[model samples]
Target: MQDNDITVLVVEDDDIDYMTVKRSFSKRKIMNPMVRAIDGVEALELLKGKKIGYPYIILLDLKMPRMGGLEFLEKLRADSELKDTVVFVLTTSKDEDDIHYSYEKNVAGYFLKEEASDSMMSLVDMLDGYWRIVQFPTK
Candidate 1:
């Protein structure tokens, strides 16, 4: 399927999880470009340096080294240029605080990665629909 113009920026630490997401999209024939960053630090650099363009959405994982998703969200929101960037929390963490804090950071949505492959497949399907109708801020 052809995505309008949305690119998925996946900020994940685990290789297996990352591959799971990629496989889901591939299986569905979704053609949206996927950029992967192992952790929040690299994710920030990618955003700051213009590696990934505007009109993109981030799929963030909560637990990661160097800087976790929450800290990244803090920095993202604090920056005037990147403050309004859309983010979706996709993590295995189901803690109450993580959920509450993620939404507090203005994340578009939150998803749990419980079943790994199956969950990722469902998540991919949902995201396909989301980007289809959603108009991202073009910075």
Candidate 2:
């Protein structure tokens, strides 16, 4: 798999955070297409309705207005069709419970949002490398 072969779904309610992701991707030269959802409910709608393609990864935030990341993960895991979807938790929450629950729900990784722009850039670079080498199940 290559970077262009995968899509990224970012579920975040904060506009600044979303922009940060975009900026980081740009800074890292990660050209993969990115889709945004304001919350878990919207993300679910997008996924369940086939609004997005396969071989995509999700960047999920734990806090939101309508539905949260944990709730979203529960729902996603319950649905057999989406159970294997790759998800990574990106949030400001440093709470141990949040970390544990996110891992319990099978997130690919959990990252804190307190890092600077440079950190985000590094994250995008790492993800780009990961998508290039990692193989995902075909739809």
**Top-scoring candidate (lDDT):** 2
User: How far is each candidate from the true structure, as Cα RMSD in Å?
Assistant: 1.8, 1.0
lDDT tens digits, residue span 13-113, model 2: 99999999998898777788999999999999999999997789999999999999999999999999999999999999999999999999999999988
Give me the displacement of residue 98 in model 2, in angstroms. 0.4
Off by over 4 Å in 1: 1-4
Kindly provide the TM-score of model 1 when superposed on the true structure, using C-alpha atoms.
0.93
Please give the CA lDDT of all the candidate structures: 0.88, 0.92
Candidate 2 Cα errors over 4 Å, as ranges: none
* Best of the candidates, TM-score: 2
